[model samples]
Target: MITSYNFYFCYIEIHEDYVKAVMKEGITVSPEHNDVLLQIVEKHYKNIPFVYITHRINSYAVDPTIYLETAKISNMVGFAVVSEDPKQKIQIKLEKTFFNKEFKQFDTLELALKWKDDMIKKYRD
Candidate 1:
């Protein structure tokens, strides 16, 4: 089953093995905002490996340092960003620096979802 949550900053869809987030336009995502993600992880994904996919439908800024805390989530197997914007691809490269685990960028959500499944399978093996 898929579950959804709407926050002031983002709209999140939680699947069995992945969480997709679409951040609101023009907002700056900071480390403090990670608390909301952490809570969702604890409540819905505790002890189970999952991937996080950020679907950038709207433009926004992200604190690279936020990945530092996100990297601590033991159950999180990978992080993927879905965006067609060339600028976002550049931003993702910088963001990947702060993340300790697998980080991938895709032009489409379908591609990201496939990567997420592969990541989870690899993690379980």
Candidate 2:
């Protein structure tokens, strides 16, 4: 079963092996947002491995530093960003630098979901 959540800053869909987040337009995603993410992880993911897929349908800014605290989540197997914007692609490069684990970029949500499955399988194996 897939569960969905609506926050002021983003909308999230939680699946068995992944969490897909769609951030609000024009907002800066900072470390503070990770608190709600951790709560979701604790409640739904717990010990199970899962990937985070950010479906960037709307324009937004992200604080690269947020990845530092996110890297501390042991069960988080990967982080995937999906965006068609060329500019967002460039921003991803800088954001990837701050992340210590598997980080990937995709032009579509389908591709990101595929990566999420592969990441979870790799983590389990």
How does residue 30 of candidate 2 score in lDDT? 88
For all candidates, what are the clash counts?
A: 0, 0
Over 4 Å off in model 2, which ranges?
Answer: none
Root-mean-square deviation (CA) per prediction: 0.7, 0.8
Per-residue alpha-carbon lDDT of model 2 for 1-125, expressed as tens digits? 48999999999999989899999999999878999999999999999999999999998899999999999999999999999899999999999999999999999889988888888888878
Q: How accurate locally, in lDDT, is each candidate?
A: 0.96, 0.93
Q: What is the total number of backbone clashes in candidate 2?
A: 0
Query: For model 1, where is the 10-residue window of minimal lDDT?
Result: 1-10
Error of 1 at 75 (Å): 0.5
Q: What is the Cα-based lDDT of residue 125 in candidate 1?
A: 95
- Rate residue 10 of model 1 by lDDT: 97
lDDT of 1 at 9: 96
Off by over 4 Å in 1: none
Tell me the tens digit of each residue's lDDT in model 1 across 5-121.
Answer: 999999999999999999999999997789999999999999999999999999899999999999999999999999999999999999999999999999999999999989999
For model 2, the run of ten residues with the poorest summed lDDT: 115-124
